[model samples]
Target: MKPSEEKPAIIALPKARRHTYYFLNYADEFKSVYLDTEIDMSEVKRRRDKLKLSGHRISYIVFLIEAISRVIRLYPEANSSVKHGMIPQMAVYHRIAAKFTLDKTMDGRRFVMSGIIPDSDQMPLEGMQKMIEYYRDTEADEITEFANVRKLQSMPLWLGRWIYRLAMGNLSRRAKLQGTFTITSLGHRPIQAFYPIISNTLCFGVGAIEDKPVVMAGQIAIRPMMKLSLAFDHRAIDGALAADILTEVKKVLEFASESDEASTQGEEVTPVGAST
Candidate 1:
């Protein structure tokens, strides 16, 4: 192999990424458990296509948020945060907040941002779409959350880390800043699965949908399948509960039909005996 004639380019880290560095530092303290499974998207895709043809378009990520939000409502423990103080405490939220990742370009460079949808279980598909559209349409610097993250980069390193810890280490503060659960997707690319450090008790990663051979009713058939990966904080939730939540989410997507309601409507669930 011939060596490159030109040297590699080295650039300074973008200010927008300071939050990520701080986040990773915090996430490193967690005991994260990873799991991935392929979900058959036959029914979900068919229903989504039908909706699109009827003029209502829903992306896979939004569909997932809708399903997961409801699942969190059913299993409130997954929507919790843990702070390892002398007396460790877990904060179980009554409302479901779904956080989704976004790719934002700032100053000719691409960066990542995220937005949270509050009371996600109560929002319909159309409402969720509108929220997503607002986030995508607005400039990153204009959003308060994104702007604040960028501002952190300008602060002294110790101060920035201190502020981040104060926010992330408190259960109530973390819930407001990071949300109850997170969902990130790379469905536009060819990747199948990946495990990510979690900011909350549960963080789900979505992979590209592709046609794969799957067994249905004792017969092999080609179906459009997507790999769903989950990273759960074992300190906040047990493996059995995490597996149950993942399984429930998988079934919810696989069996979704055109006639099924596109949202779960109800008041927020307050888990019994759960205190902040």
Candidate 2:
């Protein structure tokens, strides 16, 4: 028999299906929320002072972790994973994985930090503060160390794709591991904001805080505003649920401010007629 006649015709899957198969496994659903608040660095500094008296550093990461923990508690479904064409599965680990940029050299790389929040429910605000300080102080060396360990790791684009497929397929089943959510503060970059990408996991973007006028207690006040975007796989979480989670996060941040105010008021008072 002729070779052409003996060989069966090769059929190709639809473009969408193939694309889905290729990217969906790694694709994470992401959303962002833009928060405009009258809060500024000065306010944060003042609040930190109060928190410091209470033995805490009210850093940015601390605020983020606290807010994210609340969000996760309110909308546990957001902490889910998309695996093997099955329904999005919820993860028990209330942790968040974030990417930290290491270097800007020719091969500028990023490292992923998993389990930032140890125990969401039980994590004291001070613990979150310390974690942020640790990361800020050591992220440089840590990323370098991690990169060195992975220095020998290299794969062709096509091969990497295949590996991703296998990992997202059967291998993921064996581990059955996923975080509650993924948070990226890429907005830390000066000009970048408003990323509308989706991932297999829920994602939130923390953007640069800009100056804007906002109403606080019926008074127009200038506030440092930041964008918060939360993207989730629509398949895993519905719009209402996502909104609920974001809303809860907002409440936490606002509450933090109120808490700071109350703490500041509780400090030693200066009597009206007392001399210095």
Candidate 3:
């Protein structure tokens, strides 16, 4: 083999990864807002156990997707993307699109996959679960992010960086290519704290759920709780907006079991549990 063949070859990168590669590198003014909140899992665990007993199953990620989607519906600003600039003029998305992370092992190292769920606000829980499971199992050619990433890795790093910067310079294309927000779940890991890399206006991570003691009804109780961390672009999002979105998201998760029914019947249930 030739000496050069033994080293890495130059690659031609596709649009999405190149854009991501550049934005992450060049956007030094981008701000991140980190938050920690917990969700009560009493209802979710019950529903999950019941489904499993009946040979039906749904992952918590389904509920997670719905919760965030609903929050963005009421607060579209949370889903806005940068139109352009080191300082960006924001473009709002009327519909919510979620970007999720997945992993596959290759040669004993991690090969990351991107999962995009569009219109999660309207997708039923069952459908969301099925879609996630399908993507997790297959390396489908249609997964544009992963497909582009594979190509990006084949190129020399320095070449890839410049190509990324050039490709991402187009504001019109960038907003459409990248998801409005990102979600990463740490359920499979034992981690209790989750902080994510923010490329959009906002990104959040679902930390592990575990049983813990809490005071409820003025008495001690043990409950299952999960920690959530959210990071926001301070340039585009203010503290007030971020706080309200967090409040909205917390409400959706704690009462996730009743939210759909309540929306349909137009009657709100008395909220239970705490998140702080």
Candidate number of the best TM-score: 1
Can you give the lDDT of residue 17 in candidate 2?
32
Using TM-score as the yardstick, the better of models 1 and 3 is 1
Backbone clash pairs for candidate 3 read: 11-155, 33-232
lDDT by residue (tens digit), candidate 2, 104-125: 2122444343224445444566
Every candidate's CA RMSD: 4.7, 11.7, 5.9
C-alpha lDDT values of all predictions: 0.82, 0.49, 0.70
lDDT of 1 by residue, 59-104 (tens): 8888899878877877876789888778888899988888898898
Give per-residue lDDT, candidate 2, residue 46.
56
Could you give candidate 3's per-residue lDDT for residues 11-74 as a string of tens digits?
6554334435555685554678788788787777776676678776888777677777777776
Cα shift from native, residue 246, model 2 (Å)? 0.9
Regions of candidate 3 where Cα sits further than 4 Å from its true position: 1-29, 53-55, 83-87, 140-145, 257-276
lDDT winner between 1 and 3, please give it.
Answer: 1
TM-score of 3: 0.79
Question: Predictions ranked by lDDT, top down?
Answer: 1, 3, 2
Instruction: Report how far residue 175 has shifted in candidate 3, in Å.
Output: 4.1
